[model samples]
Target: MRRPGSGTRRLAGARVPVRVRGRGRDHGSAAVEYLGFLPLLLLVALAGVQLGLAAYAAQQAGTAARAAARTAAQRERADGAEQAGRAAVSAWVAQRSTIGGTGGCPGDAVTVTVTVTIPSVFPGVDAFGPVHRSATMPCDESN
Candidate 1:
C-alpha cells in the first residue's frame, strides 16, 4: 500500500517490457532459388528434347533407307529410290527434314540420309550442322 502524494510502485507505474516477434525475413528467396536452378532445369529439358529429336531422326532415316533399298531392288531406278526415301522421311517427319538417296541396284547398297534442324534453345550453340542421320541397306536380289 502506498500513501497519497508518494511515488510508490503501482501496476501502471511498472515499465512493460516489449519483446517484438516477427516472421523471418525472406527477401526474394523464391526468385533467388529459381535463378540459381534455372540453368540446370533448362539444360535437362533441352537435352531431353534433343535426344528425342535425334531418335526420331534416326527412325526416319532407317525407314527411308529401307524404303529406298526396297524401291531400288524392285524398280531399279534411281529416281524411284530418291522418291521412296523422300516419301518415307516426309511421312514421319516435318517437311523441313532433309532426305537424300545414293547408290545403285545390283551389288550396290542404297544409302539414305536424313537431316533435321536442331533447336537452338541453348545460347551460343550451333544446333543445325551436326543434325544429319544416315542409314544404308543392301538391295534385294530382284534387281
Candidate 2:
C-alpha cells in the first residue's frame, strides 16, 4: 500500500490520484474579482474627470472675476464689465456662469464676482456645485 503523493511507499495493486484543494471551485474567480472591482475603477475615473472640471471651472471663475474687476475699475467701463467677464471665460462655463459687481463709482473701489457651475463628469452625481471668485480694484478717479 502507498499513501497519496508519497514516493516513499509503493502500491502493489492500484494507483490513487490526489485531490487538490479548491482546484474546481477556483475557476472563473478571476473574472468575478474583476467584475467586483469594475465599479470602483469607474468611480475613480469619474472622480478624476470631475475634479478636473471643477478645477477648470474655478480657474475660469477667477479669470472672469479679474477681467470684470479690471473693467469695472475704469470709469468708462460701466456697460462693458459684464461682457468682459463673460468673454474672459470658456463658452461652456460662460453659458452657466453669472457675473456681478458692487461698489464701482468714480471715486469708489470696485469689486467684481464671478460664479460658475461645476459640471459633474460622473453620471447620476450632482455633489459638486458652483464655484465663486471675486476681485477688487481701485476705481479710476480721473474720470
Candidate 3:
C-alpha cells in the first residue's frame, strides 16, 4: 500500500500513478517550441548577415572609387586607375565589381566610379542590388 499524499494512486488490481519530481504536462514543450521557432531565428540571422554584407560592399565600393580617383588624378598612373581600384577591395568584391570613370588629366579633376554587387548569404537569391560609389580627385599636372 502506498503512503498518503505520496502522489501515487492505486485501484484494485490496477496500475498505480507515479509522480516524478520537477516534471509536468509541459515537459519538453520548450524544446518543441524552439524547434518550431528555429526557422524564424535562422531567417533573422541570415538577414542580419546579408545586411552586413551589403554595407561592406558599399564601403568597399567607396574605397575602390577613392583609390581609382587618386590613381587617375596623376597623368602617369591614369592608365592603371582601374587596376588600382580593383586592388583596393577584397578579392571577392573585386571579382564582382566594375570600375569606370573619366581620367586623363584633361580636366582639373579626375572622377572614378565603382560598382560592387552585394553578396548574398543564400544561394540563388539576388534580390540585393549593386552598390555604386564615386570619387573625384584633383589632377596632378606634373605627374
Candidate 2: what lDDT? 0.82
lDDT (Cα, tens digit) per residue for candidate 3, span 1-143: 85443465577977678665555567899999999999999999999999999999999999999999999898887899999999988999999999989455688998888989898899999878899899989999784
TM-score of 1: 0.57
Give the candidate order by descending TM-score.
Answer: 3, 2, 1
Candidates' C-alpha lDDT: 0.64, 0.82, 0.88
In model 1, what lDDT does residue 102 have? 57
lDDT of 1 by residue, 72-104 (tens): 655447557767777876554645566665556
Worst 10 residues of 3 by lDDT: 2-11
Error in Å for residue 96 of model 2: 0.8
Instruction: Report the Cα lDDT for residue 95, model 1.
Output: 56
RMSD of model 1 against the true structure: 8.7
- Poorest lDDT segment (10 consecutive residues) of candidate 1: 2-11
| Per-residue lDDT of model 2, residues 26-128, tens digit only | 7899999999999999989988988999999999999999998988898876668888988888899999898987445555678888889889776667878
* Number of the predicted model whose TM-score against the real structure is largest: 3
